[model samples]
Target: MKQLKSFIKKEFFHIFRDPRTMLILFGIPVVQLLVFGTVIKSEIKDVHIAIYDQSKDETTKEITNKLLSSGYFILDENLNNLDGIDAIFRKGKVREVIVFENNFGQTLGKEGTAKMQLIADASDPNIAKLAISYTTAIVNDYIRKLYPEMQLPMQITPEVRMYFNEEMKSAYMFVPGVMALILMLISAMMTSISITREKELGTMEILLVSPLRPVQIIVGKVLPYLLLSIANAFIIVLIGHFVFSVPVNGSFILLMLETILFILMALCLGILISTAAKNQMTAMFISMIGLMLPTILLSGFIFPIENMPVVLQYFSHIMPARYFITIVRTIMLKGTGIFFIWKETAVLIAMTLFFIAVSVRKFKIRLE
Candidate 1:
């Protein structure tokens, strides 16, 4: 019995000694809990919206104030005309626009009904639906409370228009997100694992000692994967288009260019991961845990980033997938050109250069 007890204590010590083991046992669960708790929210918060109140009447003013005071939405701009509606949405400035028809208050008072249009960017169907629903509810509630004792019940009729995706297909949302995930995992994880395999087999030293420079070695390792990943991306886009009925409304060449940039960035990130990893398993683990979770949770893929906590929302800016998904959704859904997506493209380019620079510096250290 004493020998068995001693063996159990020894096993406990062994488990505690391995940091990876302890992390898997405790750290991961805590992180998952916090991420799931904070990120997975159904309600919208601080959603940016525009308003075109042609009436500028007391009733319209009250309704606008109610929307802003509700804490779910923030006024991004007040549109003077309908021309700016498409421009704002294409620029990705606002999610929804509230357009109150001319003479709204007078019409409501005289005819007991007024027309209001709720135009939402439906590239992300869930958010658009939720925003419209919330807006409609607020308007209806206001009508009931404001005119409860009136002879005729006054109603504000909201005509909802979901831009980009009029039918609100779920595939329009998921295809872009899945594309980002697949490219990130395949490019980053595979590159890291392949490079780590060389170290495991003792071939890395031979290559390092050879006449090949660090930049050359990195490029050689990344090029094959880059080509293959581009092919993979093309296939994913094609399948999304044909099978899922997702559209490519923007410049196809620009979309492909952006896709390649993302793949290259992912490859550089994998090289960075490989620098620290000792073996294929370590590389795979880091890629899955480090890249996958952030892409899924913090990238605004499944959940809206605006709905997350302020800290999490801040952290999300660093997520590469977030930018890529935005670019993809904008090009494919909104049909915007490089002028609209230049910011996201520049961010990916900067990330690629940063990863390559770090990886090269690390390689030089190894060489020395």
Candidate 2:
């Protein structure tokens, strides 16, 4: 007990004594939270829209007024022809083009029907969907008000209540994701680099020549990072709860256990990288480029996997962080238990085992 306590104390000193390390350990979570919360928003606001109103009638004017008043869209251009619609979108400001048929009001009065084409840029599917939905709502509302006596053949009103996230704030989605990412960054990447640093500095040889077993040395080095990552995870969750008013609807204990599982997976990945790399620089490079980029881009962190290209979607299936993020979101936001995320949890366990096996093999080869 005394020896373990002494080792823990020494570990704390090593972490706190280095200002750079201390800053990275403490500062990364806060920075990531702020960046994700404020800067990275999924919701579309004031999306530029072009109107090609050939009718120039009272109905068209009223519809335009309603659309402009909705606040979700901004009328950027009054396009005179179909040729100009493509040019406006190509300029990159307009995301949607609303085209009113030439005889819109006359058709509505005579035929009791009018057609308006809604052209949306589908490059960003989420934003495109939102723009279409908002525009449809605006037009439908106008139609309801204008022709109260008219009844459509099919009338369906969707009452969408987003559970766990009433506001559907992007911050709620990113908070858990950022937590996983930062913990991985600190625990796995930093630990791998730090261990490789000792090896590069020739201190690993001295420690190997000592009575300390390789496993003991590895454990001692990783233990501090593990504890620090747990602390950072707690801090991020607390900040998300207090500062952003993000709720933890599920069991806090379960959330913590799942977070630890993910942290262990990341640490194991770091060990694998460290074993494959010859020096600290190579380890750091592998961690940043190989691990971090995939986590951010391919793990469905910032983009939904359902909408990704088929090849990229397939690529994301193998990323450990993808499962970890899914588990965190399910547990924290959806208030689900082991049953809901068991498959993802199983996947994480499998990845951890795979990484551990590969790392152990590489470490043995190095020893030989």
- Winning model by TM-score: 2
lDDT of each: 0.84, 0.85
Residue-level lDDT tens digits of model 2 in 148-225: 878777967678899888888888888877987898888788878877887898987776776666666666777888
What ranges in model 2 sit over 4 Å off? 1-10, 17-20, 38-40, 50-58, 77-91, 97-110, 117-129, 154-168, 242-245, 303-317, 350-368
lDDT of 1: 0.84
Candidate 1 regions off by >4 Å?
1-152
TM-score of each: 0.61, 0.81
Residue 117 lDDT (model 1): 99
